[model samples]
Target: MSSFARHRPAQPSLASVGPNKLTQQSLAKRLLFHSHPTDELPPIFLSETLPPELTAEVYDFIALALRAYINPWWTKITRYDKEFLPQVTHILVIVIRALELRIQRLNIPALVFHDIPTILSQHYADYRNALSKLSTSYASGGAASLPQLFSQMQPHTAILPDGKIDPEYFRQVFDYILRVCLPLEDHEAEAERIIVREVIVKVLLDDVLPKVTQPWFVQKTILDLLGPPAEGEYMGPLSAPPSSFSFHNLLIIILSVLQSFSGACIALIHAYKQAIITIKLVQHSPPYKSSTLPPQTGHTGPPPASPVADQSHTFVSPSSISTTTSTSSSTSSHPLQQWGSISAEPLTITQVGGNYAAPGLAMVSEVFSTRDRFSSNIFHIMLTMLSISITSFLDKLLPYLLLNTLCPAFILNITRLSKRTLFPNGYPGPQPQEPTLEEKAEIRARLVAWRGEGVLSYFLPLILGPRPSETLGAAVDPLSSAQCNTHLLVLLLDRVLMGLFPELADGLGNPSNS
Candidate 1:
């Protein structure tokens, strides 16, 4: 019997209190012996499921183990699989929560959107310090302790059950992003954090934002979180945590927002073009006289889109149609002929839009309406328009140097508009003093010159008119030369086309016309 007892392998003490208790204790002992104590954690660490103390313990243990205990041997054994990266980031996120808790319990200043960079800087500094302490600990322990490596690591399940992401998902995203900005090799301890962030943000921004069905709301939400694209504009301090702290990602997002804003400007231009068509309908109608009355025509045909609309429906305007139909001398007497058309160099800017407002009439309505975000939204459109104008000006190498002097005034006008109070919710009904005759005349003079020798004219020569090589004869410089003088060309066409001959009213006889 003594020999049999010696030969038998020791049974796990299963005859404890009860069968269930024995089973439970034996299983616990098996796990305790097989894996690190921390590795035995439940697959999930959700606050909804776990007690606060348990959650805190899980978070603290994971962060402490990863950052404070770098085992070169253990790290070498780590597979560094992409699948497990998020787990590391998850651990880091927990750590962040811990820091947040520490701050809150200690009554420290809570972070805000504007404090992203500062918070990131702080987080990184804290990480480095933790790493430093780990390095010291590793050196003291001679880097050979296997148990220390396992001490805080919980044994996770083979298949981690999926669940909802934490409410602080945005914070987690940025935390992982911070790690991704660094290479995997430079920071061995933070590889998991980097991988996790890449997955989270990829799912949120790349995969989700572009979804065919739900992308609109998602994209708009992202834009709202990031704020506007304009730099140096004070975005009154946000009390909530910053959506993202990385300048690298922030710049990309800002450009996206700006691109959307640019589309809005183009859409506005289209609305103006449509308005112009409506105005033309009013202008060409019969004056309702017995002499002019004829047969009632059911179809006058669809009003032809303005030729100067440049094929874009957005540049239409009521005033522009009036300028088009009126006599040239009459148009010249107005404040600015062809206002949206830029004096009818046949320039038309197209409409643009995206998820926030679809690219057509809806977008136009958004800009014109003064309700909700219209004021701020319109300001963005205006800013984008000005930027586009400036870019076009530079692109053309700043044509018509004499007229370029007026650019400062245009810029000042835009600045003044930008600083004005927002339009009220319903509509902007503010009354303004009409322009004086002298002001009208001056503006008309500038408008006439702008449409002639301005950069628009310069581009028209290349884009639509004959090229320099295509010129059949010695071409007199349009801006300068004796060819500026022409009388019969100006007088002969007036009876035929009226205001359509604005080029004729270019002060052909004026010596300083160029």
Candidate 2:
């Protein structure tokens, strides 16, 4: 027998001792054996059917060995075969569970967190190397064995079982890795943490996303995790309820994706576009409509007169009305200024969307319902991505910008409506004052301009006419800002095109804008 096998640690008898009881003993022996500079490492016994305790121990040994004993040799290590990589994935399933459950009884060390990223980075590198070799070998081998070579090129059966990718599986893996890395966000460890994030992001964008049946679904799910919960509905993978801490972790991952991957801009934008359609469908679905509608008053005509109506009957000059409006407007233009000022400073997930803190970021307001924190986070993410896409990738994004801003339906969805207008079935909440004559005249002029623009312009009023939603927090109100920002972004894109390609800009203008 080989010297390595001659000194192999004997497996403890299962009848006399449980696997959990021997964890420290196993770790100590593995660490001692691997620490020697000249001793050959023992063969790793990895199998899909390995017991959970054995799997965890194997991974823990690999992790500790890398950190404590293998650093110098790892750079020169032979590349693992594709089959080996998938078995590594099986080992990871156990680590993922421990991290997810916050299990404290595991004999895993702190260094293991650091080592996990290192192992993943190396595994993917080997995977890529194997693919490169496979392609090269196939190219030179000729058509005699093309069918067999093609079969070899198919994604590993272990990773893509039944030729289908499970995006949630990857998501769980990613979430756990990032959650473990959160404590390393400080300056001293930030660089190392960033490297790990970049590696994971590269795999996500280049490898995983391209293979998925619907890449958009994966993107939407990630954003959904980072955002607030859906109203009257749970939002998550159904593994856990939405929480602030998880949202914060997810946000970090997303920010890393944006920073690391050049193609993420396009992917996220497409996801946002898909989100617009999905949310609109959900909002109009029977469940949302029924849940959000105010109680019936049984009267459809004009509202019954009250003492407030009696006060309104006392005539006030249009000039006085204009003066008072201007004064109030000049003093403050915030939609919720009457209620109170809101902080614009960056907020922790805890301070995001509600009075009570959960596990993630939320925004709340005393003036309006702060229930839809997910909607709020989604909006902020959309705005950040739009700004980045427009400013940085304008050339590639021009087509998207045109569709979002010029398409009447797209515009209508992004703009907020008055509470009464939006929930037409009934609205018992605060009602905004009626428009003054000047305001009415302005509206009419705007309508006329819209009509002059052409048939499509008729829909612009619905898009732009609604007052902002009364919801006060960012988590609660996202669409109003989206409407304004998207309009500006398209206009900016137009001007940039005008400078670069005047003919293109000329064709891009809306009739009203022209």
Per-model clash counts, in order, read 16, 16
Error of model 1, residue 393, in angstroms? 52
Model 1, position 345, has a per-residue lDDT of: 25
lDDT of 2 by residue, 1-514 (tens): 7998999998868777865455544442333343332334343332233234443344443444233323333335653322332223333343344232221111111112112222222222322333355545444654323223322332321133233334443343343344332322221343333334444544444443332323222223334444532242323355666766678898898998877686767778988998787556444432100001011111111112221112221111121122322121111111100111112221110001111111011111211222234453454455445555544233223323332343434423333232223223322223334457676444333322222133334632332233222221111222212222222222222222212211121122223211
lDDT of 1: 0.31
Q: What is the lDDT of residue 373 in candidate 2?
A: 49
Q: Rate the local accuracy (lDDT) of all candidates.
A: 0.31, 0.31
Q: Which digits, one per residue and each the tens of the lDDT, describe model 1 over residues 441-511?
A: 44333322222232344543332223322321111111111111111111122222212222222222223
lDDT of 2: 0.31
* TM-scores of all candidate predictions against the true structure: 0.19, 0.17
